[model samples]
Target: MASVAFEEIVETFDFLEDWEDRYRHVIEMGRAMEPLADAFKVPATKVDGCASQVWLMAEIDGTGPEAVYHFKGDSDAMIVRGLIAVLKALYDGRTVAEVLDTDAGAQMARLGLDEHLSSQRSNGLRAMVERVRSQAAGAAEGV
Candidate 1:
């Protein structure tokens, strides 16, 4: 149930024979993202459980389960930033219900991230996913 953007990443990952190349591609994706404004980097948006500073500011359009989900994220670490970019592809522009329904762990597993990422990085990724889902759940409840 990955978005088209995320599917593209999966395809690219499949095409890249070397894990190192895939890793570089992820870093490139992070480099390509527009930096989150400093204004949105407040405590409210800061993601816990990350080794480096990270922020995720979600923007839900309309209300209820059908509301569209979007967010901007930034990280002090390049690899974490790349992981945020990956999360963006997975969830951005999707409806709140869709976001809620997504099996993020399974999707990320398709990229072999579970095997490749460090344990700390994996926990950070899970935290980011939780943050996104919590935001979507709030929107779904019209809160």
Candidate 2:
């Protein structure tokens, strides 16, 4: 996956004329996400704070010295799905240490997501990040 920076996404959003166009862009982004296998589709990884159903799946492979993480997520909300796609592209196939070390919240802020999102959406986004972070931490600990 190509890891586009948060700044790029923010710039793209800024360039859009209105929320409808933005929503279309977001849906397109979400459509780019690789499909998750049925085995990875579980309720436990589903985000609870979202107004729509959201599912996240993560796998940590530690056969080598470095741990690698693979993630997939789906959401009923177009923008939220796009946000998950962004997260997956950024963090997938990355080391657990890399994920744990990265300031994801700061990245999201840089993306201007908090300013653009409704309070409920922002909370849902926070929940998604927390879930990923917890998984990364657990991967690092070999859990």
Candidate 2 ranges with C-alpha deviation above 4 Å? 1-23, 37-39, 63-65
Where is model 1 poorest over a 10-residue stretch in terms of lDDT?
50-59
- Top candidate, metric lDDT: 1
Clashes of each: 0, 0
Score each candidate by Cα lDDT.
0.96, 0.76
State model 2's lDDT.
0.76
Summarize candidate 1's per-residue lDDT along 1-143 as a digit string, tens digits: 89999999999999998999999999999999999999999999999998889999999999999999999999999989999999999999999999999999999999999999999999999999999999999999999
Give the worst 10-residue stretch by lDDT in candidate 2: 1-10
**Residues 2-106, candidate 2, lDDT per residue (tens digit)?**
245545676787898686776677678888876566676678878888877789988778833268987888887777888887787567778887777767777
Candidate 1, position 84, lDDT: 97
Segments of candidate 1 deviating more than 4 angstroms: none
Highest TM-score against the true fold, candidate: 1
